[model samples]
Target: MSQANPDRPDLDLSSCDKEPIRFPGSIQPHGFLLALSPTLQVLQASDNLDDMIGADAARAIGQSLQAVIGEQAGLQLVPEIDAADIGQRPLYLCTLGIGPARHFDVLAHYYDALLILEFESVARASAADFRHLHRQVGDFLLKLTDTASTRTMSALAAQEIRRVTGFGRVMVYQFDDEGHGHVLAECRADDYPSYLGQRFPASDIPRQARELYMLNRIRLIQDADYTPARLVPALNPVTGKPNDLSFAALRSVSPIHLQYMRNMGTLASMSVSLMVKGKLWGLISCHHATPCTVAFDKRTACEQLGQILSMCIESREDANELQFRLDVRRIMVSMLAGLTQSADFIDNLSSVFPALLKFARAGGAAILFEERLLTYGDTPDEEAIRELVAWLDLHCHGDVFHTDQLAALYPPAAALAANSAGLLAMPVSRIHKHYLLWFRPEVVRTVEWAGNPHDKDGAPPAAQLTPRTSFATWRETITGTSAPWHGGEIELAIEFRSALLGIALERAEQMAELAEELGRANKELEAFSYSVSHDLRAPLRHIVGFSDLLLEPSANENLEKRQRFLRNIKDSARLAGKLVDDLLSFSQMGRAALRPTLIQMDDLVRSCIDKLALDIGARQVEWDIGTLPAMRADPTFVQLALYNLLSNAVKFTSQKERAVITIRASDEGAEWVMSIADNGAGFHMDYVHKLFGVFQRLHRMEDFQGTGIGLANVRRIIERHGGRVWAKGAPGNGATFYFSIPKELNI
Candidate 1:
């Protein structure tokens, strides 16, 4: 671990992850670092060249690669770089000969616009038998095919790698998704300390170090206290930055890590990264009690074993999950099928128990549907769950949220972790705060750490990161954790949630349509009641007034007046009958189908005005009628719509000195768009949306008498003809009502 910024060097755990470990600007003393330009000229070299290869590193700068190391090394590097995956995986070039007795194995790779060459002394080169390594890996691969379980395979792997490398202790360390490492399996010498069942903190191998292990595949530290060879130029000349030693086999490690190694009583170590599905799964960590080195050929054998182990782990886990996957799929299908066949999903709550919990592999399940909490199986109390739902509304609203250790993410859950340590939440609806959740019970297990992971040393704050001096096993009993949720379980949960959401959405659509129909029925009922009382008022008043006049005692000889009263009574009765017909028509428009025919709009507008003038009497009015066209429509409904508009125009503008009503029609695209304008006491535009809503009136009945169903009826009539209606208005500026009928509609 490199130190954080000294100015603000607070020892936070994340300091390790943020350390820049790749470009340490140095290499271990076991090898030489020679940074070269893209054209093969040496740009920088390690100062240890004098001791390592008996050459002056200063003279190597600005010099061709052949003149610096030797002609043989240069001849082998060009084709190797071109043929290899340079930036990611380092390529091995042919060895170089400095003398008859002295040979160096060279590796070449490129990054940051610079090509680099690392030369390591070929110590005991002939002893690195490739044939022996081949036999070791071959024997394992043959047995690997027969391996059945991950634990069994891990055990075999630990034994095989320890045999190949001759390390005192070899542990198959597996990392959890949270970055904690657990020694799953191990093989060790008689005198070696056993760490088979122990755990290690994630900070022991920071995120960057773990990433480097992923890229390199194999990394070795020959001696814990080996001196690092410093680059002569410190920085690369071409890039003007610290040389990127990400792919270097001899890259220097952090000093804090070296100290950690010494504390563990390990002088040498080699780590082979275990990658599964392109992610770092764990490591084949080898530790030696004495300073030791494993040759390149043997390290390659170990790396290959790690790869094979990763594949076996994936295959074995898949095999284990196959039955569980099938069961979950079956239960999900049965539940959804039942839900779709039922009128209400809540009626199928019986499945939330053993079946639903087993589907998610949880101890309990719940649904926050329709603002109610429904629980089954073992779960937290209603108070705790309601609190969780509130928190989820802010954090995981309208999405899928899950956690194996619920208390870790939501601290308040600590009180409830015993019964609900894990939670899987899926939002059922974005429109409502509805969700589906699953819970897992606390497993109540003990963990053994190599040392106390949370113990802080008595040293000062600055020394907080100092390596622990103890490797003694420390037992800890976990309280708030449950059985881990597998990726397959989470994925299956998502699919089930999606299928259930489809049902939820379908139900919502049906409910919306039903609600709309109910709303229209209620409004029409209100308008019908208002129309009966209102429309009959004038007619009833006329009948009563004329009869009173006809009953005058001295009017026996006045035959003309008596006849007039009788005619008036007859007219009022006819009007009352017409009002009843209008009420019935308006009430049935919602279900009534269109009966369309050719209609002359210009003639229709004139007829509507002539009828409206009967009620208007001698009021001053002006009508500006534009060229109204002929179109195919329901003549009766269209005439009714026209009558309502003409009547409204005359009534609302009754306050005006000279009421101006304008009617216009024009061809608009594939529809005949018409507008009726009025200079009346117009309403505010903000309430315009309510104008066409049933029984929604903007003015008082005392000012302008109406049943408040006129605009709504107009909308229904126009829409029945496959047309649309809209209005725009501002206070005192008057209004313009427009309606359009599709020109191509045969209805």
Candidate 2:
């Protein structure tokens, strides 16, 4: 392979003066370079140029340009030179099959009556520099998995390009919601002024410019000040004026663009388009002060780097989507566990996931099935979940399917357009049973996505896309521009979804089994309670009567002995009576149908406190009442719970010189928090574990009254409403009892 000298200064095409060429004459270098004709005698040839055509520069000198480029190359040059400066003209310089697909610009001038031609191959670019650029870009893409934010990714891309290309400045420019662009990332040279965060008028790069960017993807205007080629009119009869060949065909250079670059103190400009799914997402713009020409190889590497960058951005976006969906699923599972209706689950997820993930704007999400489509969030208007379900039902067999494959099934308007990259459908199952669909309205900022850690193939491609118009055709020559997503990542996602669906299905089955067992247990408990109340109670009553009879003849016996016997009978009867009552209450709490109503907790607490008015009035007590939120709960159970908590507090605090009880309430987003605190003789911390257990007490009966079931009863009541109750305190530092109620209980 032939190589150009690395030490050679980059060709300063900026000062190429425009002059009319007299092609049929003397040895004029500039004129020869300007000639559109490929057939001309060569006056001089550099060794590099000679080797490019597999010939020595000495022998190639004085030969016709066509002899070097071949007749086919001469024929392809016709349309390229005749291109008008319009939008419709093909900006591409068509390459013909000369000995090989070699591209070159021909310029000629006559001076001294010896016709001469200058040749500059379009493919000759900074190859080594581009390879370095490709490596840097690869490194940057690898770094994208480290952070999820667009700001960081964009910054990294810009900085890496600046470092590799030695650009004076580099910036990542992204369009806003309104298509107005701003510099999202900037890496400036130390000696150069900063253009970071500087806003440019939208008009500077208008809609047309953006469209051009999407089409071109990369651009390099080496030096803007070259002679403009005359616009050649279209030869064929057409409906409109020949498309502005300026956009299509290569002109020497635009003075306006050159002046603009010079004004920015930039001698060379290079920009690579950051794209997603064929659409322009953003740009990596590099600027250099000195006239610099990027060799062809280097440009190819840069294009490969650009492709890798695009993949990184896309992967990051996918990760964010996964996270958002995960969060929504988590919230929905919580909501559904409470048996909240599916509609309520949807609303709760909408408010939770986007808020946490900052997914700027999401339209809707849904799960699709053959029988029904479970739609939620902001559902799209055109393609309903039902349509997706139908499509999947028809096409699904045991592999993932995208909506694009079902285009025929959907109506013209209903069909998701290819341009709406936001429309996504992923199979929840390989068996075609279900799918997940989501819609997002805006471009997603980059996210940190875990990359495939598997080893990749290292064989690199030959050519790549670049920011120069002359190199556009080179893309077709590249074998692989980017490494595709690894099989592992896609498989991992599939496994994740499978696991999620499996867990959901298993949990539903478990719930069904538990419901059946609970029904049976309730019936048996009810039957046992009835037996104890009627059959067992009658026997205890008879025993007590017989014991009384034994102690009946009070007048005929020793009075002390008779009194002892009578006390024994009375104690036994009372013990039996208490056992029966406890059993009945426990059973009742289980069997009674829950009658949830909107009950203000404050009023309930007050009602419980009313029953203890006489006791409170007798003691020097300070009571602090707090406003409590209303909740959906059984009024009777809530009353019992409050009575138990307050009673325990009052009993413990009764020993203090001045008792202080504070009741406070607050809402904790998803739940209501109520705390009851007291300044009293707090129990030992070691005894806290037994506080809410049945028949467990921290203090003796004489100090806190009988029946160690008070706190336990409170716990049971609170738990029945899917809430939690706990106590916190130090010995003698007073104690606070806290409980939370699920907000969805109101429904």
Candidate 3:
């Protein structure tokens, strides 16, 4: 195997720079390196150039490049060398050699004012079979579109890559949210042990290695056992440091990685980066049991496949996420409807807690409303959860909050790590301090490492660079963490919070109204007493006077007078009872709980019309029921309000030959405006302010038989549903009652 120094014992990794494997200033002996000045004079040549190219290194140096490689070959390289510049991508030059019939793969790059060239021998058969290689790659690309999922696509890619490269094994590795990787798909010989489903620590591919993969999409080690060829000069004379081989196609393998591969009993390996959205997603890793070399063309084809696979993976993941979001939206609509209809928002949410938990795939959920905490599923005790909420309130920003590693973020969470290792909390109300929280249980799992990671003697020198030698599986039981929360899940949580915020605002408005009502409590009580006395006193007095008259002996004989008084007394008492009943109905409208539903306004209006048929008997009532839209509202309350409006329309239009009562609804941007119009005994516009007030009537009882509380009840019900009510009318003209309800359910 290649080594940085034959005399150096093991490897050392203490210094970040000066790591021998990183700055090897060498290439594998299978290839020779050459450096030329801008004028084409050779400045440096590898020591082994004589063995492979029949050129003495000492003699080649300071000579014209054309004299060393032959006039024709050197002339062909001039244009390529002149085009190259520092940091420029390496260009592939035609294969050529001096005094040898062997085929060489030549590449040229310019760096630090020098044109560097590398040559490695390749099989002539590979070069001649371009058509065959193209056909194979084309077949893979054609089948890629038909792949149904990432896993299936990955498996097909692995198999096709193994076939193209003739590698012993090929694996598709996928990285998780935490940067750890696992073997997602594999294609290997029957005798090869499976690494499928095995997890690899992030340490296996360190940060620097990952960065290199992004820069160089493909890397290859043709012979793990081949000796490394040292550069003629150990450092670039211009830079006074090892040449930046970051973009080099034939850069030497890291010594630590080589030692790792040797321990796995692999002689050759290659890796192609899988990128998605300009980020390194994973890798397509290939391994062989014997020294192997793939031609440049084949490697290029594999790189193309890697890019195709990356796009496929991205598309599949996006498609899946879209479907998931659709499902979430469906659930959210149902939940919102429930919340609007519910008398208490928190109670309704608790009832649908299971669905909420599914939003983030959490193991437990809790709702903190009005200073009370309600928990569901698997959760920590109430007290601990309260503390968690407190912590979140202090630390969390914005309305939605989340973390996969709760223990790491909040120390107190460590105590309940088993139950609340991950948290997704959202504040439903900023003022009321209402919150919704979801938790994921700790997922204790055993991770298998490729080898024993510990030092051999339980201690090692700090600067030692020797990679672990054993390939035995090392098991580690991880705790205090759960499965990570994905970006999609976080987005869903934020959407859910937004929906809840609407409900919270409605609740806040209702509370404000209640506060206002409380401020006027004393005045309302005084008015109630005055109304009771003024409305009920006459009936009681009439009853008493008629009874006293019947007690007179002479009056007992007066049958007509006695009958007249008895009838008058009964009429007054009945009117008094009706008034009391109307008052009670008005009060109940405000206190009754709302059960909102997606209501068909037409059906509701029709039902109300049918109920008012008795009052419209034998009348030529022309019903103009226009197209009505659906609304989210309490069905029972809406029905009651419509009944009152329709009844009033019929009663007031009694004077008309053809009573036209029209019910129609129109979209008014964010709300639906519904109108109930009638050619009735319309009131003056001056009394419009008192139209919906309690006991406020437009006509006398003899004109319209009503307790004058119908309009009041209608106004109350509509306002409770986050709506408004108003009227337009003039004396002797038609009246139109308009009410509007929000398009979206808020309360």
Best by lDDT: 1
Candidate 2 lDDT:
0.52
Give the alpha carbon lDDT tens digit for every residue of 681-723 in model 2.
7877777888886556677656765445567667867887889
Each model's backbone clash number: 0, 44, 4
Task: Report the lDDT tens digits of candidate 3 across residue range 1-747.
Answer: 233454234445554234544455677777788887777778777777877878787788789988988787777666656665545456666666445476677777776556778787775613323456568767987887643778889999999999889999999998876687878899999877778877776666777788878878998998887677666666676677766676567777677678778878888999999998789899999999889988777887888889889988887775576567668767767777777777687788888887877767889999987788999988999889888888876666464788778988898899888779988888764323568888999999887755544443243555334555565667778898888887657665665665565455456446645764655534544655665566668677887888788668876566557557656765765566556545655655655568888989999898777767767899999999999998999887888888888888999999998899988889989999999999888989988998887777778878788777789889989999999999998778889999999988777
User: Model 1, range 1-747, lDDT digits (tens) per residue?
Assistant: 233322123324345676567877778888787887767788889889888767788888889877876676556655666676766455666566665666667777777677878877776544335677678877988777644677778888999999988999999988987788999999999999999889998868987898898888888888888877778787778878877777788888877787789989998999999887788989999999888877677787898899889988876664566557667779887777667666677766544456788788888888877777889888888888888988987666324788878998999988888778988898765334677888998888899999887763455556567777787998899888888887667766766665665555455446645764777656555655564566668787998988788678644346456556767875675555344434434555655456777899998898788767667888888899998899998776788798888888888898888889999999988999999999998889889888986557799877986656678779988988889999888788788899999887755
Candidate 1, residue 722: how far the Cα is off, in Å? 20
The TM-score obtained by model 3 is 0.64
- Which 10 consecutive residues of model 3 have the lowest summed lDDT? 1-10
TM-score for each predicted model, relative to the true structure = 0.62, 0.33, 0.64
lDDT of model 3 at position 257: 78
